[model samples]
Each structure stands twice: as C-alpha cells, then as structure tokens.
Target: MKRGLLFPTTLLLLLLLGTIHAQPTPDPLDGGDYAQVYARAQAGGDAVTASRAAAAMTEYRAGGRDWTARAVQAARQATTTRPGDPDAQLALGSALGLQARAGGYTLGALNTAQQARAALDRALSLAPDRPDIQAVLAEWHAGAWAKAGIFSGGNQDRARTLATAAARRAPDTLFVQAHAGIALSLIHDSQARATLTRAATLNADTPLERDLQTQAKRVLEGLKP
Candidate 1:
C-alpha cells in the first residue's frame, strides 16, 4: 500500500496547519498586537523565539496569514544562529509548513513545503529521542504525504510508528498527544480516538496548546460517528 503519502490524509493536516487569508486574531496577551508579538519573538532568546513563534501558529489556526510568514523568518534565523538547536529547527519547520499551507499550492509554496520537511527532518536528526520532536515529525510526514503522496515523501506507517512512540513517551504533553492524535487519525489508526481523548483532557499553557487541544477535540468529535 502507498502508506505514507495519500491525498485523503491531507484534510486533517490542513486543519492543523490552519487556513490562510482569514482575519488576524487579536494578540492573546492582553495589550499585545501582532507586530509587537512578532518583534518580541524575533528579538527574544532562541528558546523564547521558538516558543513565541509557535504561538504565532495559533494565529494561523485562527485563519490569520499576516504574521505567519514573518514569524517563520524569525524562527529560521534562530536555526541559522544556532544550527544545532532542535527547538529552533522544530519552530522553523512548523512555521514554514504552516506558512506554505497558507500560501496555497503555488510553485513557491511547494518549495516552501519542501523546506519545512527538511527542517522537521533536521529537528528529528538533532533530537532522535525527544518525544516532542517525534510527535511533530509524525504529523509532518503524514501531512507531507497527503500534500504530494510519495512525491512528497510522506509515510503513514512512519507517522504511525513515531506517533505511537511519542504518545507512549509523553502521554501528558499536550503537543505530543495532540499531534499524535492527528498523525494517527490520518492513517486511520484505531488509536486516534484514544489519543485525541487524552489530548482533550490535558491542560493547555499557551494559545498554541489551547488551539491544539481544540483541534484534537474537533477531530475526536468527527470520529464519534
């Protein structure tokens, strides 16, 4: 079977990546704005850059494209400044993937998608034992496959394997369980329901994690029938 990359699996991926061109969400932090958030993420420490860049993804999930690409560039600069920083790599990969999805299916978007995959892969390479990276990579592979199938180098089985491991290793981590839920569902795994339920029960500390939990709950609800 063409396990890894299939068109049918892309829908959940798009759901997680969020839509582009919608009205930007007001900054979640009480008195903050997109420009200020972007600036803070850019000028912050690499770890802060990664974390805030991730919050920017929540904006994408809310359908705002305004800051996603710029956040990605800031996250990318973190990777360049600290080539071995796994967190930086993950943030860059994720932002690029979201930014590409926001761009639609143009040629440039395709190339950006490829870059996202490369960064995600690099993150895994840098931290093979990290459940967080594994969880993200699992969804990335599945999403990539959905975008271009084997041409996109996505592997559902690979996604399943990584997600299973991530779920087992980091059961309480919202990002891990939520992303694993997505990876599992894309592959039509029976565990999707359980994983998403687990994710739904977890506490969310950031807007990103909150959106992730909301996504997991929606996916779980869809599976109830």
Candidate 2:
C-alpha cells in the first residue's frame, strides 16, 4: 500500500515529545468558551493554561502518569459545557488514551486505544471530512497499534492503511503528513523517504504542526536497519 511520513511536528515534538503539551495558567471561565480553553491549553506553562495543558500531557501518555485523571476531569468540563462539541469529545478521548497508556499492560493500552477510536469515530461521524479529527485519529491509530500483537488489534498493516487514509483526509495538515511518515517508517519499506518528504513539506504555522514536521525530518534521517 502507499505510505507517508510520520515525523513529529516541531510544535508537537516540543509539547508531545516529552509526552504532553505544557500548560499555561488556568483562566477564568468566560461563560463556557471551550475554544478559549483549548487555545489556552496550547500556550503551556502559564498558570491559567497549565491545568488544562497538564491534563492533555497526562492523556497523551495514555496512562495514569502525568495528569491523566486531571485531564479527564478537565475534558469532562469541556464536554459538559458544550454537549455536541466534537472537539470536546476528541479531547476527552485523547485524555483517556493517556490514562490507558499509563495503565501500561498491552491489553490495557489496546482497550484505551479502542475507546479513543470510538470517540474519534463518533467525532468523524459528526463531521466526516474534518482534517483535525482525521489527523488525530491517524496518529492515535498508529501509536495504539504500533506494538500490538497481530492476535490483538495492533496490526501494522491496519495502521499503515489508516495512516494513508489520514493523509488523504488532510493533505495540507502537518499532523497528517507527519503521522503518515511514521506509519510508513514502521512498515519498513522503501517508500518511507518519499512519505517523510511529504511530511517535511507540510507548512506548519502552529507550534504543534511545526514540532511534528521537525520530528518527521529526524525520523527520516534515522531510518535504517
């Protein structure tokens, strides 16, 4: 199958590389502004945003490590305020994945990945072509299945297929390109370079995307037996 790059974007590596996004200070609630909460969470190290960012950090690790519980609580708050907000659900799912990762055990991680997949699937069902949702899902799938046993749900073949789909879902998205590269790299095939190149070409304006691109390049350079 066709493959793509899977390097970390500059911003994502900076935040997620350490296993989570750094957070700013928590801000006063502006009457349920989930978007503001999400944005603040990205700033990192701020007192107001720190709480939320910490939570994200927890979830990204997919375990009880970091602030997994706290992240889940915060995500709950976001979803509570905006019942149908797909982003809120996505946050909740991602956080849950972190909790699962911390939980360790292959089975537990698989279960958590399954939950995340369900949540992402729901979000996609609501908006089938959403680039952000697709990109995130692609990454989630890659990570979840990377080490999974074939007997379990962690098939590299499936991961490659999903990553390719993610690339098409958001060709211009840095996350999509980065994840695609990673998936290809895992396949241990000759096409990884081209896929990694595609990820490198993605222009990531945000710190998250930038980090992904940078990581992608590193992964490309590191490709070997």
Count residue pairs with overlapping backbones in model 2.
Answer: 49
Candidate 1 ranges with C-alpha deviation above 4 Å: 1-37, 45-51, 54-63, 205-208
Estimate, for each residue in 160-209, the C-alpha lDDT of model 2 and write its tens digit. 66677777766776766776777667656465677788889867655545
What lDDT does the true structure give each of the candidates?
Answer: 0.76, 0.62
* Per-residue lDDT over 80-157 for candidate 1, one digit per residue giving the tens place of the 0 to 100 score: 788898878888888887877777768888888889889989999999999988988898888877677787778988
Q: Lowest-scoring 10 consecutive residues by lDDT in candidate 1?
A: 26-35
TM-score of each predicted structure versus truth: 0.76, 0.62
lDDT of 1 at 157: 88
Which candidate should be chosen as best, given lDDT against the real structure? 1
Query: lDDT of candidate 1 vs native?
Result: 0.76
Say which candidate scores most in TM-score.
1
